[model samples]
Target: MPKMKSVFVCRSCGFESPKWNGRCPNCGEWNTFEEVDALPKSSSSAGKSSARVARSITPLKEVDLSEASEVRYHTGMEELDRVLGGGLVKGSLVLLGGEPGIGKSTLLLQICEHLGKEHTILYVSGEESARQIRLRAERLGVVGDGLYILAESDAQAIADTVSSNKPDIVIIDSIQTMGISEINSAPGSITQVRECTNLFMRLAKSEEIPFFIVGHVNKDGAIAGPKVMEHIVDAVLYFEGDRNLSYRILRAAKNRFGSTNEIGVFDMKDNGLEQVENPSQMLLSGRPTGVSGCCVLCTMEGTRPILAEVQALVTKSGQTSPRRVTTGFDFNRVWMILAVLEKRLGFCYSALDVYVNIIGGLKIQEPAADLPVAMALYSSLTDKPLGDDVIAFGELGLGGEIRSVSHVEQRIAEARRLGFKKCIVPRHAIKSTQKFAGIEVIGVSSLRQAFEAVK
Candidate 1:
């Protein structure tokens, strides 16, 4: 028998250290070191594994690529399928994370209803009892003979059940509660999460089973557990939306099989998550007919063009320093736009409390939103209303020039489909050879021209 030694690990980066420190030397994160027991290595098992392993490696060209045609399992949710790069690939490990009460469990359970009809699913819940799962399943109207529920938290026991049952797909309600008995640390610790995920990864790869692991988010909105946990998975999907709002957006933070730019939008309802097929129409619904400080912008999400409303409020400041508040839009970008407006267009903003918001809780990350933001700010400051029939999308430079944006034709087409009569784009965006119908495209060379055209 050997005595176990205590070691500290950084919760952020999974860096192991023999002693504790204020900051991790590997990742430079402070107050993240958690002390855990380090078990002695089993040399007998290690030797056995090494002895059974093959020393020869096959050449890359000699490997057969026929296995790439393995069929994917569709969740029956088009939005989810889009974010997952068409559908869930076989033998892939996906980590779905979100804040509490953000519908992480609801989404998974809902998918089982569709997947259970065609494939066997092993849904292991560590957080809730079997009865609780059944109640929720009944509430969601999910019924299937192929959906197997096991309310267990022991990792080794779950693995044994998986090996015996051999389901086509598996869903771990969450990874935090499951723990291996061999490890002395409590469940959800860094060691438990890492080891448990490693076990599931091996199970998925070796057995050709697709695994969906539900993960909880930390205070920083990152997937809970060490950062290495995210690196171990094939894909990472984050569910994001305000609790007060009925809509939830599913985004892929990392994907090995598909594009990370794609997003899935769902309207959370009492029944379940209802997919928004035409997100543009849903976002633009209930928009004020004619309003100042509001402007619609065409932004691209992956290959899909989306229309978002940029709203700004400019008012005289009553305090010593005028406030700058923004939601769903970059704060620094708002400041830069104000500075550019003041420096180039001679708009006095030093004493104005400027507030900017993106309607529908959609965060505009692209630089192409600059022109709409500027136009919205100008409209608000001047108390001039830009009619709802106009759409704007272009990038603005410090020199006040509108920079050309990509997919201008696509944006214009989307605007037209949404019944917008006019579009304000960059001068260079519209080439002499290009043409569009059903909407008037006004090309602007600078911010001044854009403001004049909008008014």
Candidate 2:
């Protein structure tokens, strides 16, 4: 028998060290190192030996492309399908991570409801019992003979079951709870997560079965596991939203089969999560009319355009350094906008406390949101109400010039559909903005011009 050796691994990046350290040398994260048993070198040597076996190899040109684009499984949920770039590809591995009680399990069970109708699914839960899953499934109206549930946590047992049963789709309720018995490490540890994910990845590829693995998020909001686990999977998706709110946003952090810019929205209810096909309308509903520091903007998420509200509040300062707080928007970017407003627009915001927020729990990262944020700040400072039936979107430069943004026509069309009477855009987009009807489009080249248009 080989003597077991121990090693310390960083929970954040999977960087291995012979001994424990207060900080990870690789990822620069402090106190993330945990001790775990290291796999014997003989085991890896055996794996390499098996890899040397003679196998038939085909040239790239010899491979057939007939089934390349034809093989896609639609999940029956249009929102999910769009995020997956049409549909789920055969033999692909998808990792879904979210905070606890954020509906990760509910979403997977919901998918099984539609996928189970046409394809056999092996549902494996490491944390929940079969009866518990059944109870939830019954509530979600998931009834199908093709769905099979297993409550085992042993990684080897799962691989054996997949090989023998050969289901079309495999759903792992979570990767953290599953572990290899031979590894001598607790479940959710870095070593166990990396090894278990590797096992599932190999099984999914060799057997050509699609896999959906659920992962947990850490305190810092990143997936709680070795970073290598993300690289091993074909895709990484994050389910994000305020737990108190009913709306949920599913965004891809990485995808081999699709674009990461795409996002899927769902409204959580007692029945389950229902897809929001028109998120623009859902977000804009019940918006206050004739309000200061409120402006609407259109942002493109992949091919879909979404309208979101930007709001700001500027009040007299009570302290020497006025507070600058922002929610669902970048703080540094907001500060830059304030600097431009002070230097270029001649706004004296240095002595005021500024607060900015993006409505509906939506996070805006695009530069196109700059102009609207600036406008909202100006409106709040001057105590002038920007009309409810107006929309604005443009990138603001340091020189106070409004820069052109992509997909101007799409943004205008979405604003028009939402009953907005006027649109404010960059001057360079006037040519494309002319085709949009029923909405008054105003082209402006600078902040002065934008304020004049709104007046």
Candidate 3:
């Protein structure tokens, strides 16, 4: 028998200390430290011995490639497929995270309708009863004959079932509720989430079956568990949108098999989640026409180009320090843009309350959005409205120069498809870009030139 060893772990970040502390040094969360076992000596040594026996090293060139081709499983959603780098790869572990009622489980259940045609799916739920899942599935019209439901929380039991049955696909309602009897920590605790995810990861790889695990986000909008849990998964997709709104955006934060920049848009309907194929059109819908402080910009979300409306309001400030507010845009970048506007372009915004917003819930972190935001501010400040058909995208420099952005051709094509008559781009990018027929492309080197061309 091995002596018991204990440690204090931060529930928020899984930071372990030999003793307890009021505040977690790593995550800065107070009163999060809880006593937990360091590890069972018997289990630790047993795991090490098993790992040594299981080790099989092969030359990189000798690795088999035959099973790697055309093994993707289409989820019956084009937007989701696009975000997933074509389709879900076999034997991959994908973690989908979002706020409560943000449609994480709904997305998985809806996909089963398509995947269940040829593949058997084991849908495991620890948080909800089988009847509750059935009720939701019925509402979503997911009446697949091959979809099996298991309402269990024991991780080892689920692994045993998967190993014996070898289902084509597995869906865990959430990792938070799943736990192993071996571990004394309660379910949803950092240790349980981390260990449970690891169990599923190994099971998915060894069994060659794909997995979709749900994760609940904390108030900080990050997945509730140790950060290691996210690292163990093959892909981490976050569903972003206001619950009060009908739209949701699934963006991949990490993807080992695909690009992380991809995003999937879905519209929440009475039935279930419906994929939005043309996210540009969906975002640009209900856009105001010929409005001052409003302009359209084309941004590339992974390989897809999306056109979003940027609006800014410049008003006289009542307070000593004028407010510089932004929604869906970076605060520090706004300050830099304002500084450039005042210093280089001779536009005084120091005493004005500047408010900038992106029309859709979609956030614009790309520097390509800088030009449009600046243009919107100028339009509101000068009380002049640019042409409704005009679209702008370019990075701004402190020296008052417009910097060229990547995916120039794709952005222009999306704008042209959206029926924009005029396009504004960096002057340097025009040298290599071909002129389009229907739209007038204006290349401006400076903010003044951009404003003059639009005027």
Show model 1 residue runs off by greater than 4 Å.
1-32, 36-69, 220-228
Lowest lDDT block of 10, candidate 2: 40-49
Give the candidate order by descending lDDT: 1, 3, 2
| Global Cα lDDT for candidate 3 | 0.87
Which residue pairs of candidate 2 clash? Answer: none
Q: What's model 3's lDDT at 11?
A: 63
Give lDDT tens digits, candidate 3, residues 230-259: 767898888999888899999988888889
Structure candidate 1, residue pairs in collision = none
- lDDT by residue for model 2 (62-166), tens: 877897744788888888887877788899999988877899999989988889889999999998999999999899888856899999999999999999999
**Which lDDT tens digits does candidate 1 get at residues 1-455?**
56668898777666788999888899787787887666335411222455655698999998776857666899989999999999999999999988778998889999999999999999999999999999988888889568999999999999999999999999997898889998877888877887788888888887889999988865541233535478778999999998899999999989999999999999998888889988899898989876899999999999899998989999999999999999988999999999999999999989999999999999989999999999999999999988889899999999999999999999999999999998999999897666788888999999999988976
Predicted candidate 2: what Cα RMSD to the true structure?
A: 2.9
Predictions: Cα RMSD each: 3.3, 2.9, 2.8
Minimum summed lDDT over a 10-residue window in model 1 is located at: 39-48
TM-score per candidate, chains pooled: 0.90, 0.92, 0.92
Against the unseen true structure, what C-alpha lDDT does each candidate score? Answer: 0.88, 0.87, 0.87
lDDT of 3 at 334: 91
